[model samples]
Target chain A: MEEVLRIEDLHKSFADLAVLKGIDLAVNRGETIVILGASGSGKSTLLRCVNFMEIPSSGRIVMNGRAVGRAVDGKQTYSEKELTRLRARVGMVFQHFNLFPHMTARENVMEGPRTVLKLDPAECARRADTYLDKVGLAWKADAHPSELSGGQQQRIAIARALAMEPEVMLFDEATSALDPELVGEVLGTMKELADEGMTMLIVTHELGFAYTVADRVLFLSEGRILEQGTPAEVLTYPTQEGTKNFLRGHGSFRLPEPQLD
Target chain B: MEHVWDFSALLNNKQLLLIGLRNTLILAAVCLGLGLFFGMLVGAARYSKKPLLYWPSTVFVEVFRNTPVLVQIMWFFFAFPIISPFDIDAFSAATLGLTLNTTAFSSEIYRAGIRSIERGQWEAGKALGMSYGEQLRRVILPQAVQRMLPAFMNRAVELLKMTSLASVIAYPELMYQAKIISTIEFNPIEMYTSVALMFFAIVFPLALLVQRFELKHKAR
Candidate 1:
């Protein structure tokens, strides 16, 4: 498998408090890696670092074989232009839908292509329609985000990210903000994307979704990867006590039984 | 016993009032245009995190906003000329004072408007690979400007009134001409009333439009 992203000795700190402590990760193309962690375990921070949204205190983030930030005097330095270019290829969907409320769903999806890509209007519109259709909200394209339900808005946000045709997609608790019933639609859209072999790094609490969709599942505890393995290994039988306690905390939910031939 | 009201002298000098009105309009228009244009730059500078941009803008905003506009006009007319590289005529002095004053106030409006937008909107723009300028222009301002329209209109109305201050420097604005007419014609009541009516005619409609916009914004 081709490696699409690599993080080496990643560290992130906010003032004196350390959020992400010496984390390392490599994601392969067409891989869906699910990160499961308790609140404040730095799952979101890790995802944010990949896109350079939160600059890692010290780390090497190599995407598609190129280091993201330039090294100046042995310290990583990021220029706004470089970060902008980096973000163009790495799309992110936030927990809050974050759709531009002033713009219609179609225009929200069209914005990146129209403004950044500088594509012709017709092409941007066409791409918007295609992606909105992909997310099953083609009919709602003309509607503003304020008019759409949480699930529908999330779907439109997904379309907006997809319109950029990014090399990788990061979902930072995308469905966590939705109502219980609405979670299904967003998770369903994500499942379809996974099925179609999209490279994804998702920080989510949805253990059931992780069980079914993840190529690999990582359990993070206290700013470090505590355990990682196949869903059957990590979810069914977590070796580390921290992972076990974490799973036990979510004990009310049941994981699917492994298929036996 | 009531003194009889006479209008013949005032009517004869109506041409002077017309020029005054024209000067008032020109000064207001020029100040508003330059103020809004520069206000965006100063506002963005104040909003920026860099100290290089932030400090100068902070000082500029504070000095212009805290001091009285009347004093500012007087300073430019009387004091600025001593230190000023260029000549400071009455019109130039008034323009300098009023334009800077408008810039200071309107920049606060712009800053507040931009700040009111949620952080998520900026993140969303960045996530889609937009530079700071692009994000502001395309996503943030498009929304902020909607919330800011009424405030800007109010500024314009205030600016229209503020132009009358130019008359203090004897620039022959509406108020200055009215002062002359009232003194010469001995019809202070009628002349002042007419000048007030002219100002009301121009400003009232704008006030109504601002109200309409506020109501519409609330509806949305």
Candidate 2:
């Protein structure tokens, strides 16, 4: 019910080409916000810049009242170690899951608490087991990411981040890389998290899931917020030419299935 | 002329032969041990992105590997004394030379093995909130060690054979010790046969062990 994240005037560029151009946004605590946009619309970059994974050329970002991603002035810079420490409180679940191949799911989950938080072995193991169990991965705790299915790997990745006990979690196209059948399991887990009052920011194109689950749905176009409202408002009524065109562009078109010939 | 082969020569002077064998073992053990340590450091240095760090390590490997081991021996035997104002024996110089040479080659071996590991290992560690040192210790090194074991053992055998180079340095190790006894007594074949057998006794088993380990790892 309270504002947990705020972004203003976000601008990002790679060489001459601009990716994100002057975006502003806010999310309340315990709300799930799904960001929808086509490829190269700067949605992913904006998500990355929000968490300071990719530095914004210029912007303002505040997460839980701590300046999350942007160094607005010369005075607000933090060292690499300090930034890593700060990131522990605001977890980012990558699009690819990015689970460590060498470590077991349990160890991967325990690593954050053991290293960054300096939690002892017993406590780390306990929390890791708890979260892994939460994701229904208790049996697969000893398995490596390579040994798990795509959906299972993503779930473990989410559990790994959750083990850190972060205040806010960011999901960057979490289910984009999954098989069609596997997508549901990961989404189901996200729904469970959302129901538990978790503050989550998700970048996804799963329109049905977004409509059913998201507290607020944001339409990103050309690196700016084109439209944003409750899912009921934006999905059905719709507004803004960019938003309408973006939806119509996707809704009217279906991928051509390969012929058996 | 002796009427029959003198296998007893080895049995009769077994004490002196054992001492020579100890010197040989010392050369192989010390050089290879130190070589592996320094090699891992150089290997890691080579993999670093900065040209300043990688180039010097690359140059060191090239200079030692391209040049002959015998020449490296002579350089240590002759030039090491001049380079170092402090006087040390040929044995020390030879040991140091062999280690540096082995390090040059083994570092590259290790570098290849380390590089062969998938990049995903590092990404996973980073995503887990691990520091670089922790990632290396927990994830990278353990997996790399498994892959590198065969190459490391092969380097050990190479180091073992390289101990023969110490004969030129007046260390009186295995080959030199045999040469000394043969020069005194006219039985060249007997003394050299014993030395060959000793090398076989040590190295052949180790080489076999490596092969077996490699096969088992493949089966896995």
Winner by lDDT: 1
Docking class of 1: high
Candidate maximizing TM-score: 1
What TM-score, to 2 decimals, does candidate 2 have?
Answer: 0.87
Question: How would you encode candidate 1's per-residue C-alpha lDDT over B1-220 as one tens digit per residue?
Answer: 8977787787899899999999999999999999999999999999889999999999999999999889999999999989978888999999999999999999999999999999999999998999988989998999999999999999999999998888889989999999998898889988988999999999999999999999999998
Off by over 4 Å in 1: A253-261
* Each model's DockQ score: 0.80, 0.35
Q: What would the per-residue lDDT of candidate 2 be over residues B1-117, giving only the tens digit for each residue? A: 845788776677677778889999998899999999999899889988999989999999999989988899888888878888888787887888899998998898788877776
User: Could you give candidate 1's per-residue lDDT for residues A8-117 as a string of tens digits?
Assistant: 99999999999999999899999999999999999999999999889999988999888888899887899889999999999899999999998999999999999999
> Candidate 2, residue A15: CA error in Å?
4.9
TM-score of each: 0.96, 0.87
DockQ of 1: 0.80
- In model 2, which residue pairs have backbone atoms overlapping below 3 Å? A100-B124
Among all windows of ten consecutive residues in candidate 2 chain A, which has the lowest summed lDDT?
Answer: A69-78
